[model samples]
Every structure is written in structure tokens, then in C-alpha cells.
Target: MATSIFFFVLLFTTVLSRTTPDEASRTKTLDITSSIQKILNPFSVKTFNSFKQEENTVSSSSLLSFQLHSRVAVRGTSHKDYNSLTLARLQRDSTRVKSLQTKVDLVVQGIGKSDLKPMESEFQAEKIEGPIISGTSQGSGEYFSRIGVGHPPSQVYMVLDTGSDVNWIQCAPCADCYQQADPIFEPAASSSYSPLNCNTQQCKSLDVSECRNNTCLYEVSYGDGSYTVGDFVTESITFGGSSSVEKVAIGCGHNNEGLFVGAAGLLGLGGGKLSFPSQINATSFSYCLVDRDSDSTSTLEFNGKTSPDAVTAPLVRNSKLDTFYYLDLTGISVAGNAISVSPLAFKVSDNGDGGVIVDSGTAVTRLQTDVYNTLRDEFVKGTRHLTSTNGVALFDTCYNLKSMKSVEVPTVSFRFSNGKELPLPAKNYLIPVDSSGTFCFAFAPTSSSLSIIGNVQQQGTRVSFDLANSLIGFSPNKC
Candidate 1:
């Protein structure tokens, strides 16, 4: 009797040691079965099908706001089925991540070189157009905003990209152009349109340019062999009837080809000197990405009001690549238990080799291989009671939750250098990958040294970029 009682006590102690009160409090009940259905057809429903022209752009005091929508939601591309569309989106996501990696590699290589003329000398060696550091495009940009392009303000959908610096649009008399939802912008009809001479300061600011018939010509090439070449011009870009920024330097692409379909062009929101935010002298910007399964629209605001409830982290600058919003991620926790990971995994080198970037374009979050392994292991251990299954695509950690109506999940949070933690929503991390109720961890491993905090993990969170103050803030459940 004594021996049996001792064994029972020992078993209880082992179980108690596995879960402390602090850790137990971090767990939340998740409706896994129901949540799985929402993500299976992520692109099936859109927040809004048609744009309300009058309400497209709204300015309140100093803030210039625009209605943001997912690319697929804006009626650009037609997919045969939801599964196929979801698969295609995932494929594009992978390609975009690879292309972003290449851009980072090139930026690092160009460091210490002539910042003003870095690409001029190397352009001849590589047959690609523009500087490699100008950034790549692959029709992978996720969010888009509608804005007026001409005097009467022809409404057009422009992809919102923080990774790119040059704003461009598909113009008329095109040698080649990808199919888009809106009719190509007719430069001849817009009285506010004017070509920039090769000698203009704006033309000279381009990473790579050529003088043709005294008009400045610009070209941007992508890692996937996509290219857009056209005349560089300045036009009056209208936000609303009362608000308009004139002579905004923009690319009028006559020859363009790529995976870019649905949207008219891209609005560059990078930290570079040529990006739209910089050109307008905007002090800050903020965006709240709505959940893919949600039918609600979100706002993308410039010079916007600050979020009082947001937890901010200092934005670390990578001198080699100032376009990306790099941050120091000190650690991560699963159910209040810190995952064992080397700080060096998230360190940004002087030359910008390895670091973490919060990108609006990428769909899935990627971490350094070692760090991701530890995170995956920790999460799996916490969720052992649930049945494990084979992962889908980029996700190696997955589970079959078809039989369960609801399950308690370990809450995940990211600890930044400022001691502020960004807690993730349950649906954001454990995403549905298929219709069979197979859910997988949304985060993936990147072989490259750079790690990306993608949109999947940022859902329902208001991410603010205060460029003037050099800070990025995360306010949860704002979308």
C-alpha cells in the first residue's frame, strides 16, 4: 500500500511539473473545427466588390486615408475554384519570399559602394533593368488601395507595397501590358499629366534611367524575369476632391509583363527617398490588415493618428537596405514559456545580412531555420493532446482536428527589444490549409538569414510605422 501510494504521488508531481499555474493561465479555448472552415476558402469572399468612388479616399485633419482591400477581393483575377485559388496564392507567396530574399542579398552586396551610383556601373554586367536594389515585383503584393490618377480622378487599384520604392501604372500605347481590372490609364486624356525631362532631379533620382528623345525612361526588373519599362513622368495624383498632390513622380509603364494582374499598378511605400510617403513628406503611416476570412474593410492611413494602446518596438535600420522595416526580436514564448533560441538568429549584421523585417507583402511569417525549429518543437509539445498529422506545403507542424469541436491552445507572443510583447490571435498562428479540417502552423522556416513577419501573423492587428520617430507599434484586435 505504501509503495503504490508513493508511485501515485510521483506521477502527480511529474504532471504538475509539466504545467505550472502561470503557463496554464496562458492557454485559451480555441474553436478549431469552426475556425478551420473560414481559411479553407480565403479568397472566396471579399470585403467589398465595388468601390464607392466618393468614399474611396478620406482625409481627416492631417491624415490621408484610403480603403485597403486584398488583391483577389478587388475583382482582378478569376480562379476556377477556391482550392485552386488558395494553392495559387500560396505559390505566389513562396515566389515572393524568394524574390525578397534575393533583394536583401543584393542590397547587402551593394553596401559600402557608391550609394548614389551603385547600380549604374553594374547595369551593363547584368542584363536586368534598373538597379537590383530597386526591389522585385511578382504580382505577389497582397493589399491594394483605390485612388484617383488624373484630374477627374480616374479610380484605379494600386497595390500597397512597403518593399518597393517606385510608384508605377500601366499606361496607354503599350508595347506589352498585363491584363488589369481597370482600363489602362490614358495619359492623353489627363491634362495634369506631363513627362519629366531626363535632366529633371526626379529623373536623375531613379536607380537606373536612360534618356530617349529627351524624355526620361525607367525600367524595373523582377527576380522572376518580370519587367516593366516605360517613360518616367509626373502627374497630379488626387486623393479626393479637396485633397490632391500634384507633380507626384510616377512611372508610366508602356511595356510591362508579369504575374501582376487585377491591379492597375503599384504604390511604393518603402523607406527609400523615392517612395510615395517620402515624396509627400508624410511623417508616419499605419495599416490594420483584416483577416482573410473577414468581410470587413480596413484603412491605410498616412500621417495618421497614433494608437494609444499599441505596444511599440524600436525600428532598427539596416544601412544597406533602408527600404525594409527591420526590428530586433529578442525572444518568443509559447504559453508563457520562453522558447530556447539564440539571439544571434535574429541579429542584423552591419552590412544587413541577417535580420527580421515586417513586410506587408508576404503571406506567411518566416523565421531563421534554427529559431523556427525550436518554436515548432515547443508548440508541438504544448499541443500534444491533439492528434498530429502531416503538414502542408511550407508548414511542417500540423494536426488533424476534424473530430474536435474545440481545443485549448497555448497562446503565442513575440517579445521585442523594448520589453513589449505582441500577442498573436489563435487563428493567426494555427491556420487551415485544406478543406478536410487539416490545420497547420502558419509560420515557416527560411533558409536565408533574413526573417519576415508576414501578413498571416498580423491579421486583426493595427501595425503602425512612425518613420519620423523610427518606431513600429502593434495594437491587437484593431481590424
Candidate 2:
């Protein structure tokens, strides 16, 4: 068996001066007194009240909002038909599964005392110019959002990533940068841009930081050999239409190279204090990833309102990997038949090693090898009549769908620790492999102990992360 390469990026620790806000502080009204004066200087109380009313209309309920869209079409030509598209998606998903396994390995290593290194020679030098969008058309699956950054804010599309913590963008005067969809962000053009000092508190919080000519420098390398090396700076970031946050800490990447093809950079949504949500003091955040077939874009909302009917689950916190969001997944059920797996399999260790995580970056769900083998065996037994075919790359179970008009695979449900069951339709598990009617089971086994609930299984569901309450809520088909 080939050694699996994990794809998740584990950020190094930087001490955060800011503390997590309590529930009371979250509900407190925004201080409009200062903002009103800044907006309308030399104005009376009545004038300020009138401007405040206008601000309310222009601003969204959420602190930040974005429309999530599939990156495949953005970087490449659209498939001819639904079958072709499905086949392409399956192939991409297969690649994503392989990368996800590697991510699990990285996560486990970070949790344990193992010294893990990046996969050697995993990336080849590809020369391209301009700001290409984040994510690749071939594989390396990703979902992106467009936001404005800088003083006379320039619009830039960024990958919405919850697994990683550093928010960065490719800046001008690039030494070694990949092609981007948009123009490189010119920090010098923005008057608000200010480089951080080496001794600054924000600079000290980064996992990888050094002093270069008295300026604070940061560098981060991913599992796939992709990396961003640049100066740390603070600038204005605008989200939604009128809502903007000032002096937001961001990585101005002068030398960035990676699989990001259709994006300018990454918008980190992880749990760390340096993440965009945490920096803005967002109470909560939620996202609804739309189905692949849907032409409509999905939504990623910061400090957004959640559905009252959404099922709630406790968000497990592990001090070791504080950047990743941990969830307690008890077991899985196939067509109402519960699989016999050890409860300890789903439990995170005291050192924060083994646990399930909900990741937006990965394409398909992955489980520990033992649990996956049992689940795969049960699935094979349940659907014996279906014509099994040679497995796709990294997917051990595949079927020939030529005989059937529609797939009749068993319904799978993810059982959470709080008794909330997330039922998945057959489409979520049985993925198409080729135009020749080959389909494969989407889930795979990982060598590492960590499990991940990837975006494929999360489609058409409203997933809300309530940092204030330490809870994660899910509403099926809410998109």
C-alpha cells in the first residue's frame, strides 16, 4: 500500500493577546457613536440619527457575507452535459479524497508527538501570471468567495477555508507567485496598508515569523508543498456592500505558489484568533454549500442568523489543534442499520489526537481504516445485486450504473454525540466515476486516527458554527 499524503495545513501557534468574548459581550450593540461622527463630521444629533438609519439599511445582518460558487467552471470550460459534469466531479472528488487522507495524517501528527514533514517534491513549478482564482479545475477541490480589500477597496476572490487559520493574499512585486484570476493586490496603492514590526504583538502570534530588515515576515507551508511567504500587514477589509472592518491583520504574500488557480488568496475561517471572524469579533458564522448541480451560488455568512429548526451539536475543543473545529461523531447507520464500531474510535484523545472534523476544503468524507472497512463491508453486503466494478483511484468500492436508470443505494446517516442524526441521500455517497456509467462509494479509509466530514456530504445543508455558544448546528436541505 502506498503511504497516504495528508492535505490539511496545520498552522503553528502564535500567542493571541485578544481573548474570546463572552455571551453578554456578543449581544452588545455596536458602538455607533464613533462611527457616526466619522461618517458625518460637524453634524447634529438628528443628522447622526438619520445617517444611522441609512447605515442599518446598507449593512447586512451578518458582519460579513459571501456567495460561494463552484470553482470548476471558473477555471475551465463547462462540461457538455450533466453526465459529463458528474463524471468530472467524481474524478475530482477521488483526488480530493486522497488529499483528505493526507490532511488527516497531518492533523494526527500535530496532535501527537510525531515529527511530520511535507511530502517531498509534491508540487512542480508552473509559471503563470495575473491573479488567478483560488482552486484548480482539474482536482484540488475548493469553494471561493469575493470580497473587497484595501482603502479604495479592490475586489478579490478568495478561497473560503475553515481548516486553516491565516488570511493571506498575493501582493504585487511577487518574487515567486502562482497565476491569479485577478490583478495582484497592490498594497502600496492602498494608503491604509501598514507593515507590522517584528516585535508587534500580532507578529509574535504567527506560527512562522521572522524579522527581515526590521519588518515582521511570515511564512506558511501546506501539506501539498504549496506555500505563502511574505510580510505581515494591517489593512481595511470590506464585506457585503457597506460593512467594512479597518486595520485587519492579513498576510501580504510576495511569494505565494500553490494549487490556487481561480482565487487571489485564502479567507481563513478557522477557530484561531487571527482568523477573519475572530478578528472582527463575530459572534457566529454559518455556510450552506449548494449542490454541485445547482447553478446558483451558496452563502457564507459571518455573525449570521441561524435557522431555529437546525439541530444542535456540541463543538468539541481540543487545545492541541485549536485551529480545527472538532465534532463528536458517535457512529454511522446504513439504511437504519447501525454499524458496529468502537465508540472510542470517534472520541478525541486527551492530547487532542483522534476526533471527527467538519472540513470545507476536503471533497469527500473519510473515516479511520478499521471503521471504514467495517462500513464498506456492510455496504457491500447490503447492495450485493449492484454490479461492482474495478475501483477508482483511492476509492475501493465502485459499481456499474449502466443497467439502472437511477441508483438505489442505501441511505446513510451520521450519528452525532448529541443524538442528532444527519441522514445522507444516495447521491451524497454514490459518486459517478465516468461517462461510461461507473459510480463509486464516496467515503474512504484513512491511515491516521482522525476522521473528516467533507463538503460533498455537507452539500445542501446549513452548517452554523456558534463560537459564542460552543455549538455547531445543522439543517438538512436548507440551501
Candidate 3:
């Protein structure tokens, strides 16, 4: 007990000790004591059909909370455990998809579909309550290829991603040979290795990043006004273990910008993009997500950190975002009470590149105009605590800083395109702040290039970015 407490204290303190103003203050004031107490509470936590009465006010700010995230991968140490080979394949497949997509795009144009592009899937993900989970990799075809099973011959770090859809990194191609933070893909030796060239179908017909010399190269822009350009390559890809060999797209080039953080490139999963090279099954690419703050570490199988009582709903699929799933968020609640707010209506769009992405990059849950007002008004009701600085409203609706009360999971039920409704965990509603911050919304505030759904609200759901179906599916389950 003492040891566990010590570790918790240590981690808690470390989280609070963040140096940056934006991060430091929030962690320090997260009210961890109360949150921990709530976690330890013996009573059964319940789910709410709606939110607190206060969530109704529309956020005065033009900006909605957006979600931006990256995965933390532990690189395999030995050459046998390296993720280098898989890197090659990821790059190769990307090129193939682009060529195929170019042809498809032309077909759509021929059919008079003005903005005709591949279809997509949309879904909602609920936030969980455990430490980040790390599931086992099932090999070439499984979701956890970053953490291969059996014994991997080569290993690499998880592909660092921006919201962009392309994932690639410099491999042996760089003689400087520094151990950049992101893993490198060695295409020279891979059996399935291939590099793009200028004559490729995509390069010849589309305006996308050109595929020259067997390399697909392009620049990606970020909400923060950042971008990266690189070449695409194909190499041997693996998952679970050696037996799970698959093809994947990989980027390789000089990524000097800090945004990529030594990352060669990103694994694209957006609807706007034309490919899913990262997926092993020539059909779909699955990008399994383990919550940043989850507790389970089963590799590919992270039994999320959701409340046990949160009810399960039908898994619905949608064509709105190609292959992504959509959530039926009918209501939100606080402290076990439903807020009197109307549900939101949604219209999906291709964010930026061609990938299935949930917008966790924004600061507040910026719903469509009408939905935004409804949810905001309901979230701020019965405010026992309130504060404002620099003209932002901060509410005390969060759990006790030391009590860990089971804030009734704010149910964000979604009515899928397939007509199924799913009620996700409640923790997705009670966001954590380092300090007494304002009620952070989950949508992007600025009418930026792409609409985003921030991570602050993805607290207890299983979000799957499947490229095979060109869908981003959200499973409303307890974390």
C-alpha cells in the first residue's frame, strides 16, 4: 500500500510539476486528492442521460476546444526487435493507395460528384479512467504492430503523428545516422521494398505530394501553423511478431521542424487522403488507440478504464466519413444529474489530408453553432464554484480535488449511420485540469482550416482509426 501510494504521489507530483504555464498550473491544481478519492469511493458510479444544468451556455469564445495528440511508443532495443522493416512497407502501400485513389477520383468526377472523394466513417469515443493501456501486438495484421509479439527482428518507435495522414521517417538513407527520436525505415533490404517515382499514377494524374523516385513527398500543415515535407517509401512491415508481416507507408526526409519531434512522419487515417498504406490487410488499416492516460497495458488489447456500470450500445458504422463511426451524443450530465440541453447535429468534412481523425486538437467541445450553445449552457448549471481570469469562465463542476467522487459519466450517446445508438462512459465529460482552469470545451474555437474534436472529451471511449474501411470508429465503452 505504501509503495503504491508512493508511486501515485510521485506521478501525481510530477504531473503537477510541469514547467510550462499552460501545463504546470493545470496539473498543480488538478485537485488530485479528490479525484483519487472518487476513484477509491466504494459507491457505484452511474451514467447520466444528460449533463448538469449549467452546460447550456454557448461558449462566448469563437474557438472550440480541439484535440491534438501523439502516441508514446517504447522502441525495441535489439535489431531483431526493431520496427525498421515495417517502416518500408508503410511507405510503399501509401503510394499504391494514391495511384488507386487518383483513378477513383477521376471516376467520381466523371459521375458529376462535385467534390467526389472516397467515402468515410465517423464515430464518437468516450474517455476512460485508467492509466494508458498497452496491448500486445498481434503481428502484421493486428492493431499493436508498434509493439510486435514473439520476437521482432527490427524495432522502431511509434510513428509520431500530427493530424496529417502520412507516416514516414528517414532510414539508413541518412548517413549522419543519428538516433532521431522517431524510428527509421530501411527500404534497401526489405523484401517488399519499393520507392515511388514521378511516373507513378498519382504523380501523373493528381496534385497530391508527388511520388518521384519511388518516394511520395509532401508537406503537412498544422493548426499551430506548422508543416513537414518528406518522401514516401515501402519496406517490410510487421505486427504482433515476425509472422505478422505486412506492407505500410513510410515517410523519409529531413524533418527539421520541432513539430515532428524526430518523427519521420505520421500514419495517415483521414477521409480526405487517398490511401491507407499503414494497414496490412490490403483492405483496411486499423490504428488502435490506447488512451494517453489509460492504466491497462495489454499491448493490442487494452481493456479500457471505463466505469463498470456504463451501459453498452450497438456498434454503428457510417458513410459520412467513409469508414468512421459516429456517436449519438444525446445528453451530458454532471454530478449524476442530467443537464437540460438539446443534442447536437453534425456534418462531417475532410479535415485536411486524407485520413479518419477525431478532432481532439481544439480546446473546447465546439459543437456546431446550435449544439455548442445547448451543451455549454447545460455544463455550467448549479455552479458551486466559479472563477474567471482574462475573461474566461471557470466552473467547479469537476470532482473534489481530493474526494475522487464518481462524477456520473457524461453519456455522449451517438446514433450511428447504421441506426445504432451507443452510450459511452461518463468520465469523458469531467475533464481534468492542472488547476482551476476554465471549463474547457472539446471543439476548436477558431473557424480554422479543419474542424476538430479535442481529447479533453475523449476520456472513456475506444476510438479506432481504421483505414481499411476509410473510417474512424468510436466505441462508447468504459475506459
Worst 10 residues of 3 by lDDT: 135-144
Model 2, 1-479: lDDT tens per residue? Answer: 12222222211111122223322222112122322222221111111111111111122546577666655423433445444544455555555444444544556566332343322231223422333323432224456677788988887778778877778899988877787767899988998899999888778778777786888877756544467778899989876656789988899988877667547888888887788888888889988887543334667887877678987788998776667788878889876678999979988887556788888877778799999998899888867878898987668898876556654556677888888876675666776655466678889887767788888788778899999988888888776
Score candidate 1 by TM-score against the native.
0.87
lDDT of each: 0.78, 0.69, 0.34
State residue 4's C-alpha deviation in candidate 1, in Å. 33
Q: After superposition, how far is residue 64 of candidate 1 from its true place, in Å?
A: 0.6
lDDT of 3: 0.34
Model 3, span 1-479: residue lDDT tens: 99999999999888767644433212112333444333322122122111111111111221111112222222221122112222222232222223323333444344423333321111001111122112101011111123211123344433422223444445555533333443465555455655666565433322235444454554332222233345555444444333344344544544323223233334444333423332332332222233432222222221122223333322223333332233333443333334454322343223312211243222233334444445555544433354322222322233333233222323344333444444433344444333332222233222221222444444445444433333345544422
**How well does model 2 score by local distance difference test?**
0.69
User: How many collisions per candidate?
Assistant: 0, 20, 184
Query: What's each prediction's TM-score?
Result: 0.87, 0.78, 0.52
lDDT of 1 by residue, 1-479 (tens): 99999999999999898877666668767777678666544456443366634356475634477777765556433555444555666777887788889878877777432353332322232344443221134336578788888776778888888878889999999777787767899999999999999899888878778887898888766666666778899887776444788889999988776656467888888888778998999889988888665546788888985689998988988877877888778889998878998878888998779889888888889999999999989998889899999867777898888888888888888899988887787888887766666778899999999999999888889899998998998888765
Tell me the deviation in Å of residue 409 in model 3: 7.7
